[model samples]
Target: MQEIKLTDVRYRPKYHIAAKSGWLNDPNGLVYFKGYYHVFFQHYPYDAVWGPMHWGHVRSKDLIHWETLPIALAPDQEDGCFSGSAIEYDGKLFLIYTAHYNLKEDGSKSYQEQNLAVSEDGINFTKYQGNPVIKPPLANNTENFRDPKIWSDGQDFYCIIGGQTLDNRGQVLLYKSHDIYHWTFEKVLATSKVSTVQGTMWECPDYFEINGQKVLVVSPQGIEPDGEFYQNHHENGYFVGQEKEGNFIYPQNSFRELDRGHDFYAAQTLLAPDGRRILIAWLDMWEQKYHEQADGWAGMLSFPREITIEDGAVRMRPIRELGKIRRETLLNESTAQGQYTFSSPCVEVQFKAMQDLAFEFTRGFEKLSISYQNGKFLLEKTGYKQRKITWKMETLDVQILSDASSIEIFIENGPVISERFYGEGDLELKFQSTKDVAVKTYRLEL
Candidate 1:
């Protein structure tokens, strides 16, 4: 089919890489096997929006550069392989996915099953004969048992799958296994309700430990559109708290939104081969109602972020390695314009509007900034041309400055904008009489 990619865009952002075409949802399987980072996602290959589902795959040695691979898993004579995770064992890569085959009489075409597939080369995957390793324990009505994320504790393996009860409450089903093929149902660990914020099913629930604490990340669908809260088609973020065995600390902190900006969901995390908890999220939504679908493409991948718990909550900072995307360096000089350039040349420049000012930047400037407005900080961009999208300073405070790749705007306090741009032309600074400001630009090389 046609591929919906950013091939036409002159510059792709640092960590976000999307498929050429069609719809993309949750990040399927993220794992480090054979020293290469492999990622899979829920994809509809035929169009820019949702169609028949398949697991789209890609890999990277470093998070910045990536190479696309063939589709990993697909629907068979029975059903389609849905969202799940992957792991490595005894030199073999194992993928666990939700297999859906209609079991209802006349088989009304509704069935949700958990299946397994194994791969040694990390490219080809073969389903086990002992498949459908674990069936839904709650009888014929529970059509929601799916998206299993399995892990280990040095001994036996454990898995958490997203599901809903007959009452339609969102929940995570717990299962345990010694061998990867057979999984036994454990008790329900943490159960969320459908009214637990107006969602039908919770998809792609991921649990892992960061440093010393535990993190439970989930994607809840059907949230009523609330400006910054339920911004996505289906929202995927996390709950930071303590989990003792199967239970979690109640009233989980205010369910923090993953990335504050548009284009992020169904995020899956994998402990990198380097011991860092790296993440990748589906750049599209589940609702099939995005404005960008008309552009001949649907979904993308959010910028890969290094997630860490700071101040009792999940605070993400783009990996430092993303700096490698810096194309070429310019304007690494100091200038005192008006009366407030500064006493010293710092890497980060902050400008405030004391009086209306007109600032001028040199032509060699690769990236320029005019942050610190009124009482807040902003990640802004303005070149000599007519292309600019600045983050409102009131919503965002901290951001990164990369040469030509793009600028990341942190809105609603954190994790918002990843507007990609190709700033290869000349750069200039103009502070209108109404907006006085001092500007700083950090140019890069390589």
Candidate 2:
């Protein structure tokens, strides 16, 4: 296969972090250190498909523009370096991740364990000599344990790893460590019964707190569609509750999707310096046809979003630093309703409407239609089922960030939808409404 230049690859994102020439997934080891925000991802550099994973590194002073760094971790005795988290301790950065090893060709026999790596300068990393620090617990399935999320509560460090029981029930295993090395099993933080909506295997678990409520976010596999929710091959959602006596307590029916989109999974969050929980997820889903694979690259990361608990629900808004890339205003109107065309594929659209409204975005042979009527929001795209959500509010406010091949639609007080589309050349946006709607569009220059 011929190597494609990064500048010439079709559908390559301008503002999003994507693999230069291979496969990428699962935002891993997100941390702020030494005046820069570091992002590490699961990457396979040899092909545009899943393989032995390595940690790909990039850093930015502001989250808008990123500079690629050297590959951080590669497979050594282990088969791959899987997803995990990072923490700044004792003036150095420490990464705790899962190491995967396959014992058979068919992968029916495999094992996963937690490992540690330390970096003095936040760029070059050295794996701990005494690796495989924490093995799979006694009652959990070894092959299904991975994606460790580690954090501290000012004293003892806590780590939560995604796992499944031997009986095929999804769960999260908790561990406690005073130092960064030796760890002890704490307890099963949470678990879900084997069902269509809650699958058997849980991956990439993240635990955090907001407004006195603890949130457990996980990606469950083998989810069968439940109406408009759990409609993807895999599902990423969260449960809000309280942690007491090492157990997470929440309503049994409290599971809600983090993003209602066709292509979103393995979300991870970073606690910013100013006390903001920011998140970024893999912008593509499992088993979906990746059109960019033909160009020798496969996946990208969603734009960083600020997470806040509002009205008993988690809300995600694009990071404010993203405004640094705004260049020219394409359209700005107090009361507008009509069709508009723009040559730039990368742009931002914002609007508010009181009455029923419809929007259509078209480019070349691809089109995406969105409508809000009678308190129900509907999204229709080519080659996929329509996604519908109910909005309890009277007014609708939407913000859309469209790049070369990806679109992230954020509805105020509602769920977000992130989708990928393929096309080339000029883009057109049409707005239809019975009454006046305030609209604005800006060209996002990366």
On lDDT, the candidate that comes out on top is 2
Worst 10-residue stretch by lDDT in candidate 2?
1-10
lDDT for each residue of candidate 1 in 1-446, tens digit (9 for 90 to 100): 45554323323333466655666667878998886889888887767677657888888888767788888887875556789999888789999999877556664858778888899899999988887888877652377788999888868889998887677767777899998877888777666643447466778899988877878888887666553356555777677777776577646335666764444678889888778898877654454344445655556676677877876677776677756755433233333344222211111223333422233332233443433444432333342222223223332224444323334443223354443333334434433325323334443332
lDDT of 2 at 357: 84
Off by over 4 Å in 2: 1-7, 105-108, 334-336
Q: Can you write out model 2's per-residue Cα lDDT over 1-446, one digit (the tens) per residue?
A: 34334435668899999877788999999999999999999999888888899999999999988999988999989899999999999999999999998888675778899999999999999999998889888765646899999999888898999998777778899999998799999888888855565778889999898988888999988777877678888999998888778689978767789998888999999999999999999999999998888778889999999999987789999999988999988888856478988887899999898858899899877799889899888989988988888776688899999999999999888879999977888889999788888899999987
Give per-residue lDDT, candidate 1, residue 265. 71
Question: All candidates' TM-scores?
Answer: 0.76, 0.97
**CA shift at 36, candidate 1, in angstroms?**
0.6
